[model samples]
Target: MKRIESSKAGGSQFIPGYVQATDYSDLESFMVAKLKVTGQLDMQIDSDFQNVDGAVSNAVVPELWTGIRDDVRGVYIGEFAFWYSDYISFIAESPNGQFTSDEEREIIEILSSFRTEN
Candidate 1:
């Protein structure tokens, strides 16, 4: 698992989450499993965005996001993607409050570091 922390001055707090890199047979299976694990199986996809490489799919649900060391209990940002048959997912959360601009940038940088060439 990979971890990233918000800066003290960023006005946000985030628990270190489990950055998952899983191998799946196909994207459909990966999506199904991801939705199940993230408690979004019954939720519809609300956003889709293009990343540096693959596309990212997201669903916002009021569910508890469990990480390696902590559980963020609130509305959290759940993002997932499939690259070269590898499934990736992570919960981007702010426990203290809303994320500031700096916090958002830092979070993106941390997530981007997990990207790999197909």
Candidate 2:
């Protein structure tokens, strides 16, 4: 798979991110199935840009299970996903276990501040 777009950020190490194009008939169901199959924890959240046009209404934070991480090693990975309608969303993850809480929030806020056209 290839990313539609991506960006790398600052800090002790890079807090990289990307915009991925995805399609799904039902996002909730798809996420639920993914979480179930993997038996991992995830959550739904509101975006800071929800009031803006084209902002996401339903957002999902699919914990640190979407990428390659050593759960047994207790890697500190952070991930976020915002779903607009059922097919569009922003997904982020730090599989290197290098993201701090502040960085995670920073990522989320940046994600929510952007208004998508579709």
lDDT of 1 by residue, 36-118 (tens): 12221112442322122211222221123212211223232323322343333444545543456776667655543442335
Per-candidate Cα lDDT values, in order, are 0.30, 0.30
Estimate the TM-score of every prediction.
0.28, 0.27
lDDT of 1: 0.30
The residue pairs that clash in candidate 2, if any, are: none
For model 2, how does the per-residue alpha-carbon lDDT over 53-78 read when each residue is reduced to its tens digit?
A: 11111123323223322121221122
Candidate 1 lands at a TM-score of 0.28
Q: Cα deviation of 79 in candidate 2 (Å)? A: 13
The residue pairs in collision within model 1 are none
TM-score for predicted model 2 compared with the true structure: 0.27
Model 2 scores worst on lDDT over the 10 consecutive residues at: 29-38
RMSD of 1: 15.4
